[model samples]
Target: MAWAGLQTALQLIYPPRCLTCGGMVESDFGLCGPCWRDTPFIGGLVCDLCGTPLPGVDDGVPVHCDSCMTTERPWQQGRAALMYRDSGRRLVLSLKHGDRHDVVRPAAKWMAHSARPLLREDTLIAPIPLHWSRMARRRFNQSALLADALARETGRTSCPDLLIRANRTRSLEGLTRNERFATLMGSIRAHPKRTALMEGRSILLVDDVMTSGATLAAATEACYASRAREVCVIALTRVANES
Candidate 1:
């Protein structure tokens, strides 16, 4: 009843709008008709390794992206909720840079849905850490926001500090694959306090986006170093362009 009243009060005070189109929304997270039809829900047969769409397949062959086939990934498996396209990029930017807290719930709900099949019953969820300098400026970490949203829906505890950013790296927008990996190699360190909790635990590594898989791999190495038995990766969006 209290939660219902809170929702009602919020709705009365602030008319909800579709996050994508800015059209009037009847209920919270209810997308406008156009947006609903247009939103790219990632479904169908996807890469068994990274969850990206594949053009051709052979049964018994391990499904993975060309990138994953060439380079080793520290995390056991990775899944993305959406491809890095207009709608996917915009949604992440809105919640991340724009500080749209309301978008977190729907975004996280979608992530949780995609991850449900892969999630272990006794898994520990952890978000990628932001460098202290970056967190200080943004006043929040987008990965932490996504993790919190998932925890609420899944009834799991989110440990945000399982990995800590040891140093800040340059923006990876234009970096080469080798360069990105080199930059991320020692950037993350496992937290000493949570060292015991990580041992033998199935860990789900959460992040807002996955570009080169470099960052997540580095973080997973840290978790593994701390004795985590298994580490899986989940990201909201992933860069799909090969070139």
Candidate 2:
């Protein structure tokens, strides 16, 4: 009962606040009702390959989105927690650029839910790596943080340095699909020292956001090159429509 009393006293001094809006909430790492409703959490029927929301009901069958149907996704399957818009966009920006480490916990829980179908008993969780130069500028890789938290949540092993950027590439922000793919091709590879860990193992690649999926494709190919049995991917958010 002492712990409970201490918790209550702490709450009085520092009440839990919503992750997105900073409003008083019943618990930490959660959103208030209005923010929760506004957040575009992907649910219901979703694409098997990319987790884009679909129109039909989920009938225990996997389906693909139009983009995924045409695009060549190297990973066996993929999922995402949110569409890159509205509250979802805000949350991603906060975590990615604003140094909001507190967002990682709840975000990992959501990613874990989306990744249920892609997980396995021996799955290895790894994050899409940033170039050393970029990592130096950012001081932390948000995807790595999310991947580590997700591994803890799912009881899986995480390797933050499983993949390494082979060369620095330009930002893909304004690039077309083909441009993005070309830029990232051969730019990522498995870390030499860590390649043995991926031998015949199923790997789950984690990323903060996926736009054209070029980065994910590069990471997936690296896993395959290292002889991983299978690879899947999950992102915090996805750009549903490239506009």
Give a tens-digit lDDT track for model 1, residues 31-128: 78888777666665566556676776446455777777887877777788877777888888888889888778888888887787558877889999
- Show where candidate 2 strays beyond 4 Å: none
Name the candidate that leads on lDDT.
Answer: 2
Q: In the order shown, what is each candidate's alpha-carbon RMSD?
A: 2.2, 1.0
Write down the worst ten-residue block by lDDT for model 1.
53-62
Off by over 4 Å in 1: 1-13, 56-62
**lDDT (0 to 1) per candidate:** 0.83, 0.95
lDDT by residue (137-237, candidate 2, tens digit) is: 99999999999999999999999999999999998989999999999999999999999999999999999998888999999999999999999999999
